[model samples]
Target chain A: MEENKKKSPYKNKAEKDALFEKEFMHLITPLYNFAYRLTFNEDDANDLVQETYLKAYRFFDSYEKGTNAKAWLFRILKNSFINEYRKNVKQPGKVDYQEVESYYNSDDIDEPITQDLRVDSVKDLIGDEVANALNSLDVDFRTIIILCDLEEFTYEEIAKILDIPIGTVRSRLHRARNILKEKLREYARNMGYNG
Target chain B: MIKTITHLIHRLIGKKEHSYCCKNCINDLYLVLDGEAEQKQEEELLKHIEKCEPCFTRYQIEKSVKEVIKYKIQHKQVPPQLIHSIKEKINGII
Candidate 1:
């Protein structure tokens, strides 16, 4: 993305449309999902996604053609969330990641969390059971899980998307998944699955 | 340290479930799971898990966690109005 910013814009309107449709337009679903996960409100998600598209279109010059448009747009939406919507977010209890990063960084790694969670238990988890577990996480953790697990971005891409080091990406992902698994285990137990 | 305290707490809170995952394999578990392990490390992990039940189960549970999230947390239907609005807005810009 940093490299793309230095390259020239699309050659002409037709070239612009072709790239936009091929790359940018095809990604709206995942973009909307990403937006919705970040915002947790349909109206706000719609507005954020629309605003991202508009901004991406307006600054289409900064985006070199045929690049990782997904990461580019995700970075834009993530920034927009932090800048524009973060202040307005009424959902309390989200912690900024400075504390999380420091706390997670210090750990030399203990046993993995959720030692009791089993394969059968995980299989029994379906739909909202899993969704709620993810939603309940801190936004930073939730974002990493979505990026690494759902979106399947490589660690390098995730680092670019989040603007953190690759090592940080790995540790953050490790911690995030551990927390997620712990939640799923708790939920499964509550649902009466012994495994 | 914090790790010891966590271990102590887990011991007190519940009976210790047998851990198939040891500390060493735990590192490989994630590196392998995330597809970030080097080719040699990945090969070692594959060979190790075959002989190790705990690490194998640990790997499966972690993989399933990712699978569940990807499958279950759905992408909402993009409101047609939102798509239409974005297109119209872009057209106006062009």
Candidate 2:
């Protein structure tokens, strides 16, 4: 009886492998997008996505069948981004908007020598310049913008992803957007637009 | 006389001119813009916007900021070589 139970056709390792492959294949694009946005570098993003997939495959048995597979995979990738990938990178200090405002307000700044700067339209402003500004933001601000604005994740989901309170998610998203707006405004000013 | 007095009191308190969206509602405009407001709050905000000019303008600015940021993110294309490399890696694994 025990031998017959062990020999059941449904228990085949190859069948399980096939099932995992089918499900895992469908999640690759979103996983790649998430990693790319987080790392902002192609090679690093690729590596992160690859590692996430490998880790998921190794632990496939632990995943519940009917639950959200994408969220589970994203949780893994987010953890990897925080614990492993971000460890080697240098994070900037918190932005003090007050200090930034005071510095820019100082009388030592030179006035614009020419008023001939051309303003680019929203379409023209949406490329590398925007990406560079996003990359330049501190990781905290960048992650909030990525989760809340770009990914359109709910504040509750973002709280789970970042392991912060929901209120923190809301407040951080607000601060992040304000900072991004300030940066974009600066870019607009340089292009001679009245932001 | 009593009805006239009540009317005068209402006008004196500026209830007729007051916006439906109060300070708290204005503060929550970002959440509304994100589509993250709870259902009741969302409904209330919509009703408020229908009557209030200042709050309506605030809503427009928030909406514009969201659109501009979204446009910026959407326009950023992943490099072709990166796509090729990812495909190659997936094929190798398969």
lDDT of each: 0.80, 0.63
Q: Pairs clashing in candidate 2?
A: none
Error of 2 at B93 (Å): 10
DockQ of 1: 0.52
TM-score, model 2, chain B versus true chain B: 0.57
Give lDDT tens digits, candidate 2, residues B1-94.
4434554576798654322135476557777877877888888888777666545655665565566566666433445665455445544553
Top candidate (DockQ): 1
**How far does residue A170 in candidate 1 sit from its true spot (Å)?**
0.9
lDDT winner among the candidates?
A: 1
- Which stretch of 10 consecutive residues in model 2 chain A shows the poorest summed lDDT? A108-117
Scored against the true structure, residue B22 in model 1 reaches a CA lDDT of 59
Show model 1 residue runs off by greater than 4 Å.
A1-15, A90-94, A104-108, B1-24
Error of 1 at A34 (Å): 0.8
